[model samples]
Target: MYCYFDGQFMPISEVSISPMDHGFLYGVGFFETFRTYEGYIIDKELHEERMNRALKDVRISLDYSFDEVERWCRRLNEEEGGRDGYFRWNVYAGEEGIGMAADRYDHPHHLLLRKPLQRTERGTSKRGFILEHRRNTPESSMRHKSFNFLNNVKARQEVTSLATEEGILLNADGFVTEGVTSNIFWVKDCVVYTPSRETGLLEGTLRHRLLQLARQHYEVEVGCYEPSDLLNADEVWVTNAVQELVPLHEIDHVSFLGKEGPVYSDLHEQYTEYVKERVSEQC
Candidate 1:
């Protein structure tokens, strides 16, 4: 695989970063992940918009233009000689600099890489999950896909290493937030329920579209949900741009009847159509 770093393209193995970089030292940076289909980026505008928003939040100066980033992505795609893959583009606090502090840094670096997209097994588990709250809060920087991921990483490790697929995160007040790396959604009486923006959920690219499309056929509620709400949910699912809509067979150990639920099927169908529309638009 090839990666673009600090204004140059290089093999992934050849790419390097300084230990002093804030992205590593202080976890100050922004990143976006998107997939390619038939050599075109999926939801390119949305990814860029989120990344730009991250930059805006931290008041970081971007030296490169949006067109430059797109150009680099296109070049890397061509060099990869493939039509479909995963792309993770990052802008990190650069090397040590004057007036450096943990609050912020200077001269952030840019890195973009392309890799093969791997799919997880779907339609396998018919059980739901049992979960323990991680006690995270929206004010704790949960929204940014920053280099700092210890919280989500640790929480995920607790679930994934046990052979379970995903876990739910909770806010400090015990309200359900999201999954390890994706947005959480559940179906109840033909309505879709997901964490609201106030819960500090990352406004995921697929998540936004999923909500929009779902509203066309069913009521989509973006609001706080507790474990009790999930317990009564007819069906539960999680979504990310990469994974799309995946049913949650179990939450912790409780089996959910999500496998054959009509609401899950509707959202899944809309999600598929959303992807198709975007890919078709690109073409």
Candidate 2:
């Protein structure tokens, strides 16, 4: 697929970054993965906020504006007949010598990647498992969707079924953190529960929106949680920008209502309408 790197658009195969880049040498980089509907990026402002927060936290600079970014994104979509696509924006500190610079990176490399969307039934359920690898603490004060993803990758390696299962990670304190690539939510006694940022999980864009929307119709709770608290729940679901929201039918032999859960059904419906409304406004 065609992608944008540096200042030019090229085939993804032709794009490359320097090995000496701090992002490679020191893991000084961040990214955002999202999807487009009708060629519109959903909740991009939220995504950008997350990106900007990471940039600020690590002293990485952005030389481009959102308008330019959106234009490039639209151009990439147009190249492929404008079908809905998965998009990833990668920003990294530019090449610096071997030693720790102890200086803010003024030049940053930016790359945009596009891939065809892989469709999954909206209400489909995925099994969940507790991973053996504990989630590492945030590199900075708070977690950003940064290139420091090896910890997540290592934990995901333990999943028995990648296609049908999601592996949840815990922190050193053994509190439920999140799924490999998604934020987790469970329902008990009509209340929705999810791990807070204090647990060191990258708060996904959709997860942020769900917290606000869920509050309008249901009592929502966010705090540190243990496996037993989640296991005792009646329903469970995971959220990410690409997948939106997915129900987990079982975790550790504990069965949930999955798509049939009343809370899941109502929230999914609400979330769907919310997307449609946002898409219409963009149109």
Candidate 3:
């Protein structure tokens, strides 16, 4: 497959980087994962804005412009037959001297990965996730989508062993925050609720859109919530750019009838139409 590095497009096999890259050595990098629909990149602007915010938060300088990245992404989508596939954008400090000093010369790298869409269905449609409440400290880059993901990986592995789709993280005070790879949402008495941005959750693009849509149908509130709120929720769901929205039928051992619920069906239908409209713009 063809990939983008620095400013050039080349075969993925020919891509190379230094062994002292900060991303590999100290995990000091920011990245975003998005998918394409037809020839258009989904939520293109929002993803770029978020990546910019992440870069600012981590003090990583992005050497390329957003338009340049967008053009390259669109080209990859069309050339690699990526009608439906994932794309990864990475920016990190380049290899420098061996010490862990914060001072170093940094050169950002960009990679465009193309592959067939992966449709993974785990657990029942009506079943939700059983999260082991563990929160990485604020200093650990939990709020940024950086390359340091060993903590998330370890938690996800534990949840997978227990046969769950995703894991939920809670802050030190025991308030539900977010999932390892997605954002969490729930419906109660026809009102939708999610954790506030102050909870250190990565701002998900799809999560932002769904909240706007939900506001039209019901009251949407962002606040701190405990795990008990999830157990009591009449309906639960998770959202990501690729997954869209999937109903959560259970949390931990608690069973919830989310998939067959009226709220879930209605939102899912609306989300499908939203996608169709965006993808049709490319044609």
lDDT, candidate 3, 158-201, per-residue tens: 66442236677787778888777788898888888899877777
Quantify all predictions' global Cα lDDT against the true fold: 0.73, 0.90, 0.73
Highest-scoring model, TM-score: 2
Error at 56, model 1, angstroms: 1.7
Point to the candidate with the largest lDDT. Answer: 2
Which portions of model 3 miss their true places by more than 4 Å? Answer: 65-67, 78-82, 100-106, 120-126, 140-142, 161-164
Better of 2 and 3 by TM-score: 2
Tens digits of per-residue lDDT, candidate 2, 1-283, equal 8999998999989988899999999888989998887877778889888899889887887867665677788889899997778989999899887976686899899999999989988888999988899999988888888888999889878987656899999999999999998999999999999999999999899998999889998999999999999999999999999998899999999999999999989988998999899989877
Total backbone clashes of candidate 2, pairs 3 or more residues apart or in separate chains: 0
TM-score for candidate 1, please give it: 0.87
- Candidate numbers sorted by lDDT from highest down: 2, 1, 3
Could you give candidate 1's per-residue lDDT for residues 48-149 as a string of tens digits? 788877787776777676557667777787886745677888998777644456454447788988887775565444233444646355434536777767
What's every prediction's RMSD, in angstroms?
A: 2.8, 1.2, 2.9
Per-model TM values vs. the true structure: 0.87, 0.97, 0.87
In TM-score terms, candidate 3 sits at 0.87
Scored against the true structure, residue 109 in model 1 reaches a CA lDDT of 81
